[model samples]
Target: MGLYDRYLALRVRTTDAAVPEHVALVITERDLLEQGAYDTLRDFFAWAFEYGATDVTVYVSVLDRAAAPTLARELEDLDAPREVAVRQPDDVERADAPITVGIGLGGRSEFTAAIRDLATAVDDGDLDPDDVDETAIEDRLVFPNDPDLVIKTGAERLSDFMIWQSVYSELYFTDVNWRDFRERDYLRAIREYQDRNRRFGE
Candidate 1:
């Protein structure tokens, strides 16, 4: 490891701030089009796990729906450190791998679909309206785990990621583009998260 990277690792190891077990990353399709972007993503997964995150969620926002399939195939080809489960926009199945990648899956659409499923269950006498709480909604989401920290690269806008899950999660935004992201950048994010006093929606 580089001298600066070792120093950052030591800082994280010595800090009192709680390390986020589940970390989420939001990037755009355009960002992936850049050279060496996939390599950065693999490094990101390694860093997250090395820094104590057990689960990593990656959301790749898409402007053109047609590009989703191509993107999914490429993401599946990534040499990630952990098993990766890639879900497309229309998929309603739950993902339970250590790494979950959502390609062009809009958070609003996912939430709306979950609500629709609950309503259908109610009409079928399978569920009661009163029991349609947050858990009910979460049970149907593709990526249901609420991340402790969400990182958005190259942009500040959330772009509709994890609407139901991230209500209380701490968010970190960086101007650095995905292709240019490095291990040091990930460590910097960890350091920044350590400095925050989270209120958890208080």
Candidate 2:
């Protein structure tokens, strides 16, 4: 660790506020195409875990459906700190690993699919329409873990990810692109998150 990185880590460790346990990152497929993108991701996981994050979720937006398979394969093969679960757009199965990656799965499509599943259950007499609620919707989500903090690099806008889960997450946006992201950037995000007085929309 460099001196500045050590300083940022010290700040995060000494903060009065609680650090985020679950962290989410938003990036595009183009970002991963850049040189050393996977190395950046590996470092990100290391930083997250080092600073008290227990779970990490990465949402990679893809404009082309044909690229989904290749992206998934690459992400799954990343030499990360922990086990990774990579899910495609049509994959509804829950990802239970410490690190989860979602490729090409927009939030709108996920919500639509959840609603479709709810409707099917209602029609089949397995669940009543009146019983359907937030839990019902969440149960049908692919990556259902709600993050305490969400980080978006290179843009202020979220890349249509974890709409249902991130309703109360503290968001951190940085102009730094994915390829240039460093451990200091990750620590800065942790420090920012630690400084916030999280009021879950209250």
Candidate-wise lDDT, in order: 0.91, 0.91
Number of clashing pairs per prediction, in order: 0, 0
TM-score of model 2 vs. true structure: 0.97
Looking at candidate 2, the ten consecutive residues that score lowest on lDDT are: 8-17
In candidate 2, which residue ranges exceed 4 Å CA deviation? none
Residues 7-59 of candidate 2: C-alpha lDDT, one tens digit per residue: 88888898687999999999999999999999899989998898898999999
Q: For model 2, what is the error of residue 51's alpha carbon versus the real structure, in angstroms, after optimal superposition? A: 1.0
- Per-residue alpha-carbon lDDT of model 1 for 63-83, expressed as tens digits? 998999999999899999999
Instruction: List residue ranges in candidate 1 displaced over 4 A.
Output: none
